[model samples]
Target: MRPMMSPPLLSPSPCSLLRFLRLCHAPRRRNPTAAPPTPYTFRRRPLLLLPVAMSSSASITAPNSVVADPSALARKVAAIRAAGPSKLQVIADFDGTLTRYWYDGARGQSSHGLLRQGNEEYDAKREALYEHYHPIEICPDIPLPEKAKLMEEWWEKTHGLLIEGGLTYEAIKKSVSDAAIAFRDGVVELFEYLEERDIPVLVFSAGLADIIEEVFRQKLHRSFKNIKVVSNRMVFNEEGRLVAFKGKTIHVLNKNEHALDMAAPVHDSLGDPNGSIDDYSLVKKRTNVLLLGDHIGDLGMSDGLNYENRIAVGFLNANIEKSLKDYSKAFDIVYLNDAPMRGVVELVSELCP
Candidate 1:
């Protein structure tokens, strides 16, 4: 068996590099109000870091990388590979998973965050809602049920604001034009590879379906026959004004395939009538899954299907210290510091080969 090469390293942002260099060179000045810095180390932790290279004949050799159970993971991979691409499907989270988490020293925007409602006041209110509920969304102390309920509330309120703000479809297009959003490196190649192999990929997001499709159309500039998007879709009026949202709300917790009943597939508008989220019975037969997501809750994306072999890849984009252990326990593989999708593409090549 050939050795698994390390994934490509991400280049540091120039602005961030300059800031770090200045801090290192400047004189040490103590501020009483500043909180003590959190200690971060890669050694001897239960969870490992990214670029974790593994070979069929060898165990995980990357010091910073972690696999919850190397032997078990290898077994799972072997099973899936034996089953081959015929039984494989990819389920991915849209926002931070497929898209870059950080870009140019700043956090990238989610599908929902790319909107500009044309009303400054309403936009401000939405930002305020994000500020309040985002912490609860990520708080490990909060019970899952409670957090889910809060997320439902936040989505409902935000959608209501969008309706009240007289949002237009034109605004949605303009938002995408103005937003600083980009897909992670290698995502396009992954999609292309899967498409070539006739493998179905379900992009399940709790974000706006229209926004996600726009990203594909405007940003990606190409559409795949095998990719389908399921999310909260907006119902537009004759004038293309946002009127209401279709189906039930899909919050962070209920974002799995189980919630497929609540939303319709977004691919029909792209001139394909075969793949509908409401009735994609064919996908259920593919009993091996490769799930990609940024949040630990994303593991549930496969809850609706009973897969004989499954691999869950988690992207630990932020608050690593607070969530790494839980992520390690939940996911088969966890990529740290918003690692690119090249590792995932490599994994697919291995599995589908």
Candidate 2:
């Protein structure tokens, strides 16, 4: 029974209109008194916006309505998801990161070990380092700095023996085929996923490059597009006989510098769109990193990068209980005696998916 309201008044001014329509026949210019066009609000529709952000220049927190706990890691995953595909990067060590750490309740094999020729000989010099420095490597009583020094000694001695023994291309190839190495479960999946997402995954290693590339190409079935390897490649003669290492030999302790120096250019090539990079530049920088390694010495594998959010996962093979605490403090995640990389694969998938 309410009385009808009177008709609303039509304003003479065009400024008050919700949406103003300009006629094709009308032409106006240089009206100094005219106001600017309505401010573009850029308002988001209810159905259009997605909440995926790792960090922002502007941040004002709101109370959570959903009870799902947002742990720091979960929030990181969310931010990466929002960042979508481009902002993520992975840096991993080859031997222990991708290759299995242990199998069938036995000490696992290294990638190089997979190429181990049945003629695995006992070199006195190499054996000496193994005997002397191997203890220091696993000595829980020793500090990391001390262990690092011993590791250098160990790696140097091992490489020195190879240099002295005149390791040949034929010998190395024969060794590789005879080796009993295998990839950790889900490693191929992890690599493929990164490739699928257009994320860069750099394998920085102290191992042999030719062997790793062979294994990757043969097993993973993807040419190294998403993958970049920085390692000690072999130098071959015109006839393809191995002469020596292509560059300065890579070792466990000195891997960081080599990794940065080698991978910097590749990162650069991937970072930009112009495609001018050629003849090998190693100066590309990345913002975010998911670093993986199996050795305690592997922590520095991805060092020297200007990284933003870095998540390091260490695969623990020997001395799990003792190494767990140290590895946990040193790495974001530690998989102790884990046969495969279920945890890492899961994390990457969640962050990137």
Per-candidate total of colliding backbone pairs: 4, 16
Tens-place lDDT digits, model 2, residues 94-120:
876687544443544554444432234
Best-fitting candidate, scored by TM-score: 1
lDDT of each: 0.75, 0.54
TM-score of each: 0.82, 0.67
Task: Tell me the tens digit of each residue's lDDT in model 1 across 1-353.
Answer: 12133233334345533442232232222212212222234656554333333223242121133467654566666667667788899999999899977655577889888799989999999999999999998888898988889999999999999999999999999999998788887798999899778888899999998888888888887677777787888899999999999888887888877666644444555665555333367788888899999887787788888777788988877677778788888888776656567677767876786
| Model 1 spans > 4 angstroms off | 1-40, 47-64, 261-267, 271-279
lDDT of 1 at 119: 93
Query: How big is the positional error of residue 165 in model 1, measured in Å on the Cα after superposition?
Result: 0.6
Model 2 lDDT at residue 54: 18
Q: For model 1, give the RMSD to the true fold.
A: 11.4
